[model samples]
Target chain A: MTDLLPPIQTTARDDAVLKALAGFVRQEALGPGEKLPTERILAERLKVSRNTVREALTRWEGLGLVERRQGSGTYLKAAVSPDMLHMPLTLAGGNDFAGLMATLEIRRALEAEAAALCAIRAGKAELAEIERKLDLMEEAFQTRDGMSSEEDWEFHQAVFRASGNPLFEQIIAAMYEMFHRFWEHPLGVRDFGHASFPYHRTIFNCIAAHDPEGARAEALKLIATVEDDLKRGAANLKLSDRR
Target chain B: MTDLLPPIQTTARDDAVLKALAGFVRQEALGPGEKLPTERILAERLKVSRNTVREALTRWEGLGLVERRQGSGTYLKAAVSPDMLHMPLTLAGGNDFAGLMATLEIRRALEAEAAALCAIRAGKAELAEIERKLDLMEEAFQTRDGMSSEEDWEFHQAVFRASGNPLFEQIIAAMYEMFHRFWEHPLGVRDFGHASFPYHRTIFNCIAAHDPEGARAEALKLIATVEDDLKRGAANLKLSDRR
Candidate 1:
């Protein structure tokens, strides 16, 4: 069995560089879009190697915290504390059974909001993308069960994008990525979310019809089906353990 | 003016290490709590120095993606795609005016959900913590304005913790960190959420009363007040530009 590990550690070198960068930005009172000092200058001042600075900046770029211009210097994309840039969104429960339930609860809220927003805001391009993803999901599920299907994931992602809120898309995409990474093996579920599969079309139709309340109701129903599947999967796991 | 930078770059070395770690985890089919190869082993196998592997692991630890025991090897804390491990929750709009508005919109949904859940799930300890934070916020605001007050921030964070969902706390904390970093200077706001201040006590009362619907409604009201502040802030910025 894995040992119970304490959740504390000395700061990593790259992390120290990030912390130094935050200090520098705050000391200089740099606002969004303001150019940061060059990598060489930052490294010299912060007493870290240029590669460390570059790597930290690159990671910040990925997080939408900074922008590195080709000819110009790197600029602050967002005004965030050092701590905010380091850790991605995740549950303390990790990938345990409890974590999955917590994720479902969070998704229940987010998906409902996304569907409602999509219904009111999705444009022609977003609608087309959603429909295309739904078609892909349907075709994929026709050949096989919907367990861990990439198309099913893509359909949900498209719906989030249709919500016209990039934060929802980012947050949900991360959660789904984490969920898909573990859902099949540990749960021993072969055909999860199949019950919720038909709701995709109804949700799409509601959005297409510009009915926010209808879309939200359908999304919640879809989540409820997934929750039921999750409970049943857990029960089956328990039964198999006894056997 | 800051240069318009393209959001594309070659992967950094540490990022390469993280990607390789993900590949390693997948190839080995490491599940949650499964032991990872030692840093020395991973460095040798992945053709990197031990320092790089250690740094990557430390970052993963911060993201709650891995846990490092003292004597035992590092264990996978969560089954997450590598992409999810790297970027914290953030808006694509960054820290600009648009980003603030987008953040407020996301918070509207999250805060209401959090408040409702806090009412249903918060334990006595959590409730006490919430009360403590609210008292601190009240005390801090009595001495001065509430703009960018740490106490005010802590109060909201405590409420999020009471929601019993770590993801909500994580996501909202990141948003507020990013928001607080820029809200004062660019917007020229000396005070914020003052209009929403009294609502905190009311919301706390609802949570204390175990009133989920009331908590949710008051949370929405708090966000609505902030939204009005944002609109007024923008209009004031325009007026100042003319000056």
Candidate 2:
């Protein structure tokens, strides 16, 4: 387990402290629900201040890796297992183009599968919710309300919810901001009106018809359309840069 | 943004404080690198103790959402954009069977796509690494070293690396622990010898041949084989429970 975490950079004392505490947890082979040594003990062991230990513990708690019981002490809420994966693309810093493309690729895979699952498993209420969102998109298109993007997002989220896999919903939800940003201000594509409404409606129709394969195809097509737009936009940017 | 974050269950004062800080950041539309108000000011504004504010900031820092600078103050390191997605499944708690199934389904989608991408993008060196892992798997089988599983994992990881998408690698890497556990002591499945060697070889061959669709098909077939075993194992468990 210790081998999983790379060496901690000693740039910040707090970061080093956090890494040390994580190392301790990994070294001890502590699993979820395990108790940790007291802060004083940890501070003494790591040769760090108690305040540093406290801060690190607090941070771990926030990350959902540990839990603190007021009187009992802090317990390992989740094990930082050696095999656990880390988030590769972070939205924190300015978005990297490669990261953005990688993210879109992932989204395509997930959303495509989600559409298939929604076709097979979506309940009546869920289907209705999706339809309602579609109606809102159409209404926005007709009224020029410029709210189709919001409705479109809701429609996709409805598909995720209908997939009945909380993990899918959660993963997509986690990328919701990135996806939302991409769709609204899509790099090269300017028009956000009813351009993609037909594709979305075809997706809806496929799901409504209980055609998993068809829904998957439609979803992929929809994603392809966006990807094309992004490529075109990127090319335009390049051309402009050259000019 | 409030609509995006579910109500924070007020189980602990610190949790409440954390939620409030998150809310403040959202309401104020804090972006990445934005400076947060001083701890003293935050405590006064949120009506929480300074200790509580410190604890919450520490937690946020741990979560990679904020950064604390010794002399300046704490600043938002990342935007808590309302559109941001949240991780749906956590490996911290005991692994629930449903979560496991959901995770496998996700792995299937990701790995299948990764194989396709690898077929299209992998360079000669990347292909050689994958081939090396396969050779190691075969050697383990012949030697009866029982290290086939590790080599098998390496093979899949190599595919992810070949995909040229760091995000795919990261997501799979995150799920490594779960996948490792699933393969090792799968509910009822045993015999981790060269049983799936043919399927893996076919996947490798497809990639080497630069056949994206074929590689995808082979990857899905490989995943389906495992899924079948898992399903059968799950059924066996259910029957045993009934007995």
Candidate 3:
């Protein structure tokens, strides 16, 4: 039972400090705009170093949990409640087929919207960058037996950025990294279908043509194909492992 | 000129080490399956403490950049290129009107998809949790002149979780946190319209009925209202500042 519980003290001292401070705030019933104790005081109360407390506060500031005013003191920026304390700000990095499928669903939503937005909003520089990434992907396909997943990833990232929404780029990049953790082969390998490769160019053309609906349709079709391919790949990998 | 460059040496020693190691990988043109040098050697080369090196490697493992086999050495799981090193996995935390609007665009994409998925995949328990969150929001609305943004946030979080897609929940949570950093008032204030408050029940009813299309349509309509209200709020805030 003890092993089942996570060790409160570990190398992740900053994370531990974050939890401790959150607990302290909750116990005190601190509300928004309420000033928190000094870093030194928090360190002493938590029996940790001042640097650790500072690091935790800095992270909290980034998460909008607290605000540090110059010389005024740190204050709560939002209400700290029991449920909010444990809300993860990133993916839990699950390594399973279902996790992969769920991530793809998110990608489908993001990618389709991104393509439409890019069609309407991509600037000349952004469009040029997209074209450059596409050129690189084409080169890789021509020269290699298998498409370069890295190049393919870069192409999609370019499209996401062209959407002019940084959140889309950030979230999709994180998903790409998380998928790499458990996938045995490159993610592109699972992207089956001979027509899938050319769809990249078609999607690009829609964006360049400034056809938002066309771009959205093409992106949706592409992801739907990738989803079918992923199902097939999962089954094949399962059979091979069993053999 | 010196001030223009970010200090390579800072309290974020682990991040510096990450950059150093990524540079080393690129210089060596290391590909997947290539083994990295021992920690001691890497620490010596980078002139950092062994602990820093270990922390960097642990972070890299989490990012799926490297894999450490038990009793063996760390190996590159994917190609480390110039662009991959600079790619940010989180938002840059822009504090401006355009940034807020951009984030809302992402929310629209994720929220619509999540509501649709929740309608199809949410279990009885998840549906009960969603209803419970709605009850809390309704109670808050009944007692307060202004809606509680926190309650509203919790309600949306429950819906995201009910989607059975952790990515949707994680990404949306990050965006919510990012927006809070700069917004002067509660986010829910921008959620205008009498119909808007009632839309929550409509959304919940759609999900409860297991009507994915209805849920998706309602979610999109709600976000569209929020977006328009946001534009109006921005104009009002600008006018007030001028006054």
Highest lDDT against the true fold, candidate: 1
Model 3 agreement with the true structure over A1-243: per-residue lDDT tens digits: 011212246767877876666666677777889998888777766677786677667656645567887678999976654334222233332455676787889889999899999999998899999999999998987786444556877899999988988668766775676555534353344445444678899999999999998998899888887787777777766745421
Output the lDDT of residue B19, model 1.
73
lDDT of each: 0.77, 0.73, 0.74
Worst 10 residues of 1 chain A by lDDT: A82-91
Estimate, for each residue in B85-160, the C-alpha lDDT of model 1 and write its tens digit.
3336644335456767777877888888899999999889999999999988898778665643578778889998
Colliding pairs, model 1: none
All DockQ scores: 0.19, 0.19, 0.13
- Grade the docking of candidate 3: incorrect
Model 3: residues with Cα > 4 Å off, grouped in runs: A1-90, A179-195, A239-243, B1-90, B179-195, B239-243
Worst 10 residues of 2 chain B by lDDT: B85-94
For TM-score, the strongest prediction is: 1
Instruction: Write the candidate numbers in order of decreasing TM-score.
Output: 1, 2, 3
TM-score of chain B of each: 0.68, 0.61, 0.63
